[model samples]
Target: MYKIAPRISQLTVRQVEQFRSASAWVNPSRSRTESGPEASIDAEKLFINPEVQQLLVELTGMDLEGKVFRARRTTMQQRSHFALMTDERLSETMDKMRREAQRFLSFIPLKEPRSEEVTILSKDDDIKAFDNSKFVFTDITFDATDQDRTVVVREVDGTLRTATPEEHDRMNRVYYEKPNRPVFPPPVFKDPYLQDALARKEHEFVLDWACWFYEPDDPAYVNLVQCVCDRTVDNNDFEVLHSTRHFATLVFYLALNGNIPPLLNYFGGQGRIRDCANLVRLQKRLLPNWRFAISTSDTDLKIVTDFVKQNSRFHEALKDLIAFLKDGVILSRASPKVGSSFSAKAVPKVHISSLLISAFYS
Candidate 1:
């Protein structure tokens, strides 16, 4: 007869309790039902089974005694083996599924997201050809917080992740860097004297050049001239005599030709004639030919008046000049002797008006 050690029995009891706890078997009803002779027989079989005894000792450091529990021993081994096999099979299945998924992905043609479609619509379509063969893989990581959230795309490296903003910025910088290509240079003034004269507010020189360069048909030249005119106006000291003279000459020629496009285009709009009427007075002294032609006759006066009305602010000056001519005051001041050369004859200051009339007729 074998003597059952009390310590070994107590260890077995602890092992049973531990297994019950791990399996969550706290049913009071089951415990009550199993307290009978049937339960005692089941307990005796579990202690006597060699496999159950080995498993108990290995798993829980407990030894079985007395009779073998064959039914309980078989049940426990089946439960543990089923759990282990199920986990192993699941892991293998997942790995095989992942490989198959990758193979299928390789066969199917992949495309960039449609949001990239507009990149091809640009003028240079040849630079935007799509090639699916060099497709690279990427992953996104998301971080969560109540106040702020961020998502980043990164290339996969085993299990570690890194941001791609620096790479993106570098690519963009390279793509947009200035291209090394030739472009046409702006037109430059060829005349050294004229260029040097225009370097200051040489209004007379500019006026003369404008008169020579005024081509209504060539838009490019006109635009270039206008740019120079604007630059002269901006850089020249307006109060200086040369600056004022240049402005005066510009107005005089603009009025004489009745071609106001350059003035209108340069100044951005039609301006009051009176604003430059003082220029007319100055032109009378400096460009007598211009004044002689403009103030010569009623027709010439009409031309001047029309230009003044269209583009001048000096309405009072125009009215006064028209009134003076009409009243014969200007004619009396310019009384000329017949058959006299304009320069050699002793012509009265009063004859200046007659000279003006003759110049208009000529």
Candidate 2:
């Protein structure tokens, strides 16, 4: 006789919890029930993965060697302001970017959410009557918004707690089915299909759809996005991202995992030295104890040098980056300002990049 798998509903309480724990990757740092905008950073699944580190090294080498630098398909105001606008506009853009970056980096909460005590169901006579199955209850009131809907679950062991995002979504679909959301998750979110979509450069499409389909805090959403993000790093396909929205999120994810060297290399290769410095500033902001010497007066080039010298991770691609920075300095000095209104004779002394320095310092 062939062995058969037991149905999930028939599993014992401890067995069910074990299976859930095994299948779902929960962020231990946050509440399992709370929903929020920020996705959990799974360090083990990302930077700690051997494949990911190898890919980062490869991308850094390519970028530092000037082999992967190309004109971006889309324009980013903050990155393009130096060539596209007057000094005043450039300064304003940089200031806005700096404030935004600071806000994003400063909100790191190390404290996890406090777990709530379970409320026993009053309807259960002995409390052991329905111990064999988990019961879920949802607020079906007409005015209840899906996002604000109250969904709770009573586990097989008689423990009552707020339903997880996945469970909450399921309950919402059952009561108020949206035309776009399916009863079950789409197959595209898994395995070969996701890899195929990423390879085709449909990252933006996939991410947009994921935002629409799953709540920001949904485990499915988090997993899908991070998987896509890891692939982007692996392929060094930043250009395919097309806009600043997801790009900033990607940068934040990298910084969260202490992996910014490849991103630095990419910016340096693209001749965006200010962007490189901004990235280093972001790193320092995230890690307060970084102990790097930086000030408003320090050139962006110097800031990048500080990162390279202190972080041993930068050793592998150091020579190429240094050479690129040197060439950038020389080229900036020799070439006339391409789009600035200033006369050739009135051009200010050249820095490593056309980046506005004061904003990053702030």
Candidate 3:
């Protein structure tokens, strides 16, 4: 299958939230219903598969031991501040990245934002205005969320719980999902058609945050998401969408707020945070045909060109990053997510990715 193909960002607010809100609690080793308690091994189908883990490792060299490190490059502010060196600097770069990841794990596990970190765009006393005309708009500000969003949690004994008012405030303020994004179904299969499509034209990337549920061949059982996309961009070209079920990232701030817990998705939340971090990937790369973004506004391309032109080093670095991401997916297609053994290893500093770009994977 073509790892990355032409794409169009066009899913609605509810649609994106549905994926975020999807609660699949099935333990493959156990016979529990989606509602019952599951053993600590069933993956969320999209985010916990072996294929997904391998992809994460290849792309970021991540060990998937979320005890730390997703903090550095996953946030908007942190992302805008990153720059890569030539391969010659790879060692030094990796060293610096290791320190950052360690700090993320040892000192500051991604936590909820301080009161000073959040800025309310609207006045609290007066109103609530939203756009529902098209795309079920929930957030007007870029990457921001509706003021009244709530959070759900999986309790200690395997029962699902809605956060109390205090927890809700913290949850909503951090890694909250918004409707400003447009989603598209990209063709992820490595087939002659995709090869042909790419040979004809290169693809544009807009990295978006996502978590996969099933391996490539599994039916995946999430009929809600399937039905929604089938209505818009279904043509048996779902290479990207399927992989999304398993790729996880910091979904908001530079902190580890709502990121999907690797094992929770796999083991059904053994007192782990439901969604893991607060960093958002633009969730852009998850969407397709991002080149259209430049067509509508050259500003996007100009920003990239300017950044790339800063030096040959940066230009080359960007190219290498893209190539690595593209190659990672291609490599992953061959090692389906099924055979991975949940029993595993937790590691030291080396888990940091040589690529510090946003943990943004397609």
Q: Which numbered prediction scores highest in TM-score against the true structure?
A: 2
**Stretches of candidate 1 exceeding 4 Å from the true structure:** 1-126, 129-197, 201-220, 229-312, 315-362
Candidate of highest lDDT: 2
How many clashing pairs in candidate 1?
24
- Which residue segments of model 3 deviate by more than 4 Å? 1-23, 27-91, 98-362
- What is candidate 1's lDDT per residue for 1-362, written digit by digit as tens? 02322322233223323322111111122221112112112222333345433322221211111111112323346533334458889888767755553332221111111110111101223423333232222212244221111112222222212112233222333333433211221123435654655565353335434333322212233333444544544442222212122333223223323333333222211122232333333323322343233453434334443444443443342443433333322211111122222211221222225544333223
Candidate 3 overall lDDT versus native = 0.27
lDDT of 2 by residue, 79-153 (tens): 532367889997997677655543323211111111122323233335755657888878798987876676777
Could you give candidate 3's per-residue lDDT for residues 46-133 as a string of tens digits?
3443444333323222232232332334336443356676986977777776666533322111111112111111222222223222
Whole-model lDDT, model 2: 0.53
lDDT ranking, best first: 2, 1, 3
Clashes of each: 24, 0, 57
Q: Which clashing pairs does model 2 show?
A: none
lDDT, candidates in the order shown: 0.30, 0.53, 0.27
lDDT of 3 at 114: 18
Which 10-residue window in model 1 sums to the lowest lDDT? Answer: 112-121
Give the C-alpha miss distance for residue 255 in model 1, angstroms. 6.4
